[model samples]
Target: MSRRIKGLVEFEDDNGAVVRYLRHPHGGGLVSPAAHAHEGAWLAETSYVEAGAVVHDGARVGPGSWVDVDVVVGARAVVGSNVHLGAGTRVGSGARVGTGARVGERVSIEPRATVTADQVVPDGATVGGSGTGRRSGYGRAA
Candidate 1:
Protein backbone atom coordinates (compact mmCIF):
# COMPACT_ATOMS: atom_id res chain seq x y z
CA MET A 1 0.00 0.00 0.00
CA SER A 2 1.21 3.51 -0.87
CA ARG A 3 0.87 6.23 1.68
CA ARG A 4 0.02 9.81 0.96
CA ILE A 5 3.29 11.67 1.00
CA LYS A 6 1.59 15.01 0.79
CA GLY A 7 -1.69 16.76 0.21
CA LEU A 8 -3.34 17.69 -3.07
CA VAL A 9 -3.99 21.19 -4.33
CA GLU A 10 -5.77 22.50 -7.40
CA PHE A 11 -4.26 24.72 -10.04
CA GLU A 12 -5.44 26.10 -13.36
CA ASP A 13 -3.76 24.78 -16.45
CA ASP A 14 -2.95 26.73 -19.57
CA ASN A 15 -6.17 25.51 -21.14
CA GLY A 16 -8.18 26.81 -18.18
CA ALA A 17 -8.73 23.35 -16.78
CA VAL A 18 -8.47 22.85 -13.05
CA VAL A 19 -5.68 20.38 -12.50
CA ARG A 20 -4.70 18.90 -9.18
CA TYR A 21 -1.21 17.99 -8.07
CA LEU A 22 0.25 16.01 -5.20
CA ARG A 23 3.00 17.64 -3.25
CA HIS A 24 6.13 15.57 -2.94
CA PRO A 25 7.61 14.33 0.29
CA HIS A 26 9.40 16.91 2.39
CA GLY A 27 7.90 19.53 0.13
CA GLY A 28 10.15 18.41 -2.68
CA GLY A 29 8.14 18.86 -5.85
CA LEU A 30 4.68 18.93 -7.36
CA VAL A 31 3.38 15.94 -9.28
CA SER A 32 0.57 16.69 -11.68
CA PRO A 33 -2.69 14.79 -11.59
CA ALA A 34 -1.97 13.30 -14.99
CA ALA A 35 1.66 12.45 -14.21
CA HIS A 36 2.99 9.25 -12.66
CA ALA A 37 6.15 9.10 -10.56
CA HIS A 38 7.39 5.94 -8.95
CA GLU A 39 7.97 5.92 -5.21
CA GLY A 40 11.71 5.76 -5.65
CA ALA A 41 11.80 8.83 -7.86
CA TRP A 42 13.44 11.78 -6.11
CA LEU A 43 11.87 15.08 -7.05
CA ALA A 44 13.52 18.00 -5.33
CA GLU A 45 11.48 20.84 -3.92
CA THR A 46 10.43 23.47 -6.47
CA SER A 47 10.19 21.18 -9.48
CA TYR A 48 6.97 20.93 -11.45
CA VAL A 49 6.14 17.90 -13.52
CA GLU A 50 3.54 18.66 -16.14
CA ALA A 51 0.71 16.47 -17.34
CA GLY A 52 1.43 13.06 -18.86
CA ALA A 53 5.02 13.08 -17.61
CA VAL A 54 6.33 9.86 -16.06
CA VAL A 55 9.26 9.69 -13.69
CA HIS A 56 10.41 6.16 -13.23
CA ASP A 57 11.96 4.57 -10.16
CA GLY A 58 15.32 5.88 -8.98
CA ALA A 59 15.10 8.95 -11.20
CA ARG A 60 16.15 12.20 -9.52
CA VAL A 61 14.84 15.54 -10.69
CA GLY A 62 16.74 18.42 -9.16
CA PRO A 63 15.23 21.60 -7.80
CA GLY A 64 13.45 23.96 -10.18
CA SER A 65 13.43 21.48 -13.02
CA TRP A 66 10.48 21.75 -15.32
CA VAL A 67 9.36 18.52 -16.91
CA ASP A 68 7.02 19.53 -19.69
CA VAL A 69 3.99 17.72 -21.10
CA ASP A 70 4.35 14.10 -22.14
CA VAL A 71 8.00 13.97 -21.13
CA VAL A 72 9.40 10.69 -19.85
CA VAL A 73 12.30 10.69 -17.43
CA GLY A 74 13.55 7.14 -17.59
CA ALA A 75 14.59 4.99 -14.66
CA ARG A 76 17.70 6.11 -12.77
CA ALA A 77 18.03 9.19 -14.93
CA VAL A 78 19.50 12.21 -13.13
CA VAL A 79 18.15 15.61 -14.09
CA GLY A 80 20.33 18.39 -12.75
CA SER A 81 19.14 21.49 -10.95
CA ASN A 82 17.05 24.01 -12.82
CA VAL A 83 16.92 21.91 -15.96
CA HIS A 84 14.18 22.71 -18.41
CA LEU A 85 12.94 19.70 -20.26
CA GLY A 86 10.67 20.85 -23.03
CA ALA A 87 7.47 19.17 -24.10
CA GLY A 88 7.80 15.59 -25.37
CA THR A 89 11.43 15.33 -24.26
CA ARG A 90 12.62 11.85 -23.29
CA VAL A 91 15.57 11.29 -21.03
CA GLY A 92 16.42 7.68 -21.63
CA SER A 93 17.12 5.20 -18.87
CA GLY A 94 20.42 5.86 -17.09
CA ALA A 95 20.83 9.15 -18.91
CA ARG A 96 22.14 12.20 -17.03
CA VAL A 97 21.08 15.73 -17.84
CA GLY A 98 23.57 18.15 -16.33
CA THR A 99 22.71 21.15 -14.22
CA GLY A 100 20.92 24.02 -15.92
CA ALA A 101 20.78 22.24 -19.25
CA ARG A 102 18.29 23.84 -21.54
CA VAL A 103 16.74 21.04 -23.56
CA GLY A 104 14.63 22.38 -26.34
CA GLU A 105 11.14 21.14 -27.09
CA ARG A 106 10.70 17.57 -28.29
CA VAL A 107 14.32 16.54 -27.79
CA SER A 108 15.04 12.85 -27.33
CA ILE A 109 18.11 11.57 -25.51
CA GLU A 110 18.86 7.97 -26.31
CA PRO A 111 19.32 5.36 -23.61
CA ARG A 112 22.48 5.92 -21.58
CA ALA A 113 23.16 9.19 -23.36
CA THR A 114 24.76 11.81 -21.12
CA VAL A 115 24.12 15.43 -21.81
CA THR A 116 27.24 16.75 -20.16
CA ALA A 117 26.58 19.18 -17.31
CA ASP A 118 25.10 22.46 -18.52
CA GLN A 119 24.79 21.32 -22.13
CA VAL A 120 22.15 22.89 -24.34
CA VAL A 121 20.18 20.87 -26.85
CA PRO A 122 18.19 22.60 -29.54
CA ASP A 123 14.59 21.78 -30.28
CA GLY A 124 13.99 18.53 -32.18
CA ALA A 125 17.61 17.47 -31.66
CA THR A 126 18.48 13.84 -31.05
CA VAL A 127 21.39 12.88 -28.80
CA GLY A 128 22.40 9.26 -29.06
CA GLY A 129 25.22 6.76 -29.52
CA SER A 130 27.47 4.97 -26.96
CA GLY A 131 29.37 8.00 -25.68
CA THR A 132 28.98 11.67 -24.79
CA GLY A 133 28.55 13.72 -27.93
CA ARG A 134 26.17 16.37 -29.31
CA ARG A 135 24.69 15.84 -32.75
CA SER A 136 22.30 18.34 -34.25
CA GLY A 137 19.54 16.56 -36.16
CA TYR A 138 16.41 14.46 -35.98
CA GLY A 139 18.10 11.03 -35.93
CA ARG A 140 21.45 9.27 -35.95
CA ALA A 141 23.43 9.40 -39.16
CA ALA A 142 23.33 6.33 -41.36
Candidate 2:
Protein backbone atom coordinates (compact mmCIF):
# COMPACT_ATOMS: atom_id res chain seq x y z
CA MET A 1 0.00 0.00 0.00
CA SER A 2 1.01 3.62 -0.54
CA ARG A 3 2.52 5.42 2.42
CA ARG A 4 0.62 8.39 3.87
CA ILE A 5 -0.68 9.59 7.19
CA LYS A 6 -4.32 8.70 7.94
CA GLY A 7 -5.60 10.69 10.90
CA LEU A 8 -5.68 14.02 12.72
CA VAL A 9 -2.05 14.96 12.94
CA GLU A 10 0.00 18.14 13.34
CA PHE A 11 3.33 19.15 11.87
CA GLU A 12 5.56 21.77 13.48
CA ASP A 13 8.62 23.42 12.08
CA ASP A 14 11.14 23.88 14.84
CA ASN A 15 14.17 25.64 13.46
CA GLY A 16 15.16 23.67 10.36
CA ALA A 17 14.26 20.23 11.70
CA VAL A 18 10.78 18.75 11.50
CA VAL A 19 9.23 17.81 14.86
CA ARG A 20 6.32 15.45 15.36
CA TYR A 21 3.73 16.20 18.00
CA LEU A 22 3.32 13.87 20.97
CA ARG A 23 -0.21 13.78 22.31
CA HIS A 24 0.86 14.64 25.87
CA PRO A 25 2.51 17.90 24.80
CA HIS A 26 5.76 17.67 26.64
CA GLY A 27 8.70 20.19 26.82
CA GLY A 28 6.41 23.07 27.81
CA GLY A 29 4.90 23.71 24.40
CA LEU A 30 2.48 22.23 21.94
CA VAL A 31 5.16 22.85 19.34
CA SER A 32 8.67 22.57 20.68
CA PRO A 33 11.81 22.25 18.61
CA ALA A 34 13.36 19.84 21.10
CA ALA A 35 10.74 17.27 20.24
CA HIS A 36 12.46 16.82 16.91
CA ALA A 37 13.47 13.35 15.77
CA HIS A 38 17.15 12.53 15.50
CA GLU A 39 19.18 12.42 12.25
CA GLY A 40 16.60 14.51 10.43
CA ALA A 41 14.20 11.65 9.83
CA TRP A 42 10.90 12.58 8.20
CA LEU A 43 8.42 12.77 11.05
CA ALA A 44 4.75 13.05 10.22
CA GLU A 45 2.59 15.65 11.94
CA THR A 46 1.32 14.67 15.39
CA SER A 47 3.25 11.41 15.12
CA TYR A 48 5.85 11.45 17.84
CA VAL A 49 8.70 9.04 18.17
CA GLU A 50 10.36 10.00 21.42
CA ALA A 51 14.04 10.67 21.96
CA GLY A 52 16.36 7.62 21.75
CA ALA A 53 13.91 5.98 19.37
CA VAL A 54 15.51 5.11 16.05
CA VAL A 55 13.55 5.19 12.83
CA HIS A 56 15.87 4.01 10.10
CA ASP A 57 15.92 4.13 6.32
CA GLY A 58 12.62 4.66 4.51
CA ALA A 59 10.57 3.77 7.59
CA ARG A 60 7.32 5.70 7.65
CA VAL A 61 5.48 6.46 10.88
CA GLY A 62 1.91 7.48 10.18
CA PRO A 63 0.13 10.42 11.76
CA GLY A 64 -1.23 10.43 15.33
CA SER A 65 1.09 7.62 16.44
CA TRP A 66 3.47 7.53 19.38
CA VAL A 67 6.64 5.45 19.34
CA ASP A 68 8.12 5.33 22.79
CA VAL A 69 11.61 4.85 24.24
CA ASP A 70 14.32 2.82 22.56
CA VAL A 71 12.05 1.41 19.87
CA VAL A 72 13.60 0.44 16.56
CA VAL A 73 11.56 0.91 13.41
CA GLY A 74 13.49 -1.09 10.86
CA ALA A 75 14.10 -0.19 7.26
CA ARG A 76 10.97 0.15 5.12
CA ALA A 77 8.63 -0.71 7.97
CA VAL A 78 5.34 1.16 7.91
CA VAL A 79 3.81 2.26 11.19
CA GLY A 80 0.18 3.25 10.94
CA SER A 81 -1.69 6.18 12.41
CA ASN A 82 -2.75 6.26 16.07
CA VAL A 83 -0.59 3.22 16.77
CA HIS A 84 1.42 3.01 19.97
CA LEU A 85 4.64 1.01 20.08
CA GLY A 86 5.71 0.40 23.64
CA ALA A 87 9.28 0.60 24.86
CA GLY A 88 11.88 -1.68 23.27
CA THR A 89 9.57 -2.90 20.53
CA ARG A 90 11.16 -3.85 17.21
CA VAL A 91 9.26 -3.49 13.98
CA GLY A 92 10.99 -5.69 11.43
CA SER A 93 11.92 -4.87 7.90
CA GLY A 94 9.05 -4.51 5.43
CA ALA A 95 6.43 -5.33 8.06
CA ARG A 96 3.21 -3.36 7.83
CA VAL A 97 1.81 -2.03 11.08
CA GLY A 98 -1.80 -1.12 10.66
CA THR A 99 -3.53 1.89 12.17
CA GLY A 100 -4.51 1.74 15.84
CA ALA A 101 -2.18 -1.20 16.56
CA ARG A 102 -1.16 -1.36 20.20
CA VAL A 103 2.09 -3.29 20.38
CA GLY A 104 3.31 -4.15 23.83
CA GLU A 105 6.79 -3.83 25.30
CA ARG A 106 9.70 -5.72 23.74
CA VAL A 107 7.56 -7.18 20.99
CA SER A 108 9.08 -8.64 17.88
CA ILE A 109 7.68 -7.96 14.43
CA GLU A 110 8.31 -10.70 11.93
CA PRO A 111 9.28 -9.44 8.53
CA ARG A 112 6.56 -9.36 5.87
CA ALA A 113 3.71 -10.06 8.26
CA THR A 114 0.72 -7.75 8.11
CA VAL A 115 -0.39 -6.56 11.52
CA THR A 116 -4.02 -5.67 11.19
CA ALA A 117 -5.23 -2.40 12.70
CA ASP A 118 -6.15 -2.46 16.40
CA GLN A 119 -4.30 -5.74 16.93
CA VAL A 120 -2.45 -6.03 20.20
CA VAL A 121 0.76 -7.99 20.30
CA PRO A 122 1.57 -8.54 23.95
CA ASP A 123 5.01 -8.01 25.44
CA GLY A 124 7.56 -10.41 23.98
CA ALA A 125 4.87 -12.05 21.91
CA THR A 126 5.23 -13.30 18.35
CA VAL A 127 2.49 -12.67 15.83
CA GLY A 128 3.22 -14.53 12.60
CA GLY A 129 4.17 -18.17 12.17
CA SER A 130 7.06 -19.40 10.14
CA GLY A 131 6.40 -21.99 7.48
CA THR A 132 8.23 -24.53 9.63
CA GLY A 133 7.88 -22.67 12.94
CA ARG A 134 11.64 -22.61 13.10
CA ARG A 135 11.85 -18.90 12.40
CA SER A 136 9.12 -16.36 11.98
CA GLY A 137 9.19 -13.97 9.07
CA TYR A 138 11.68 -11.74 10.89
CA GLY A 139 11.45 -12.60 14.55
CA ARG A 140 13.91 -14.14 16.97
CA ALA A 141 15.35 -17.63 16.50
CA ALA A 142 13.40 -18.99 19.41
Over 1-73, each residue of candidate 1 has an lDDT whose tens digit, in order, gives 1234347766666777776678866436888878988888999978989899999998999998999999999
Q: In model 1, which regions exceed 4 Å deviation?
A: 1-6, 11-19, 131-142
* C-alpha lDDT of candidate 1 relative to the true structure: 0.82
lDDT per residue (tens digit) for residues 23-44 in model 2 = 3222121222333443424456
What TM-score, computed on C-alpha atoms, does each candidate reach? 0.80, 0.64
How close to the true structure is residue 13 of candidate 1, measured as C-alpha lDDT? 64
Under the 3 Å rule for N, CA and C atoms, how many clashes does model 1 have? 1
Candidate 1: C-alpha RMSD after superposition: 5.1
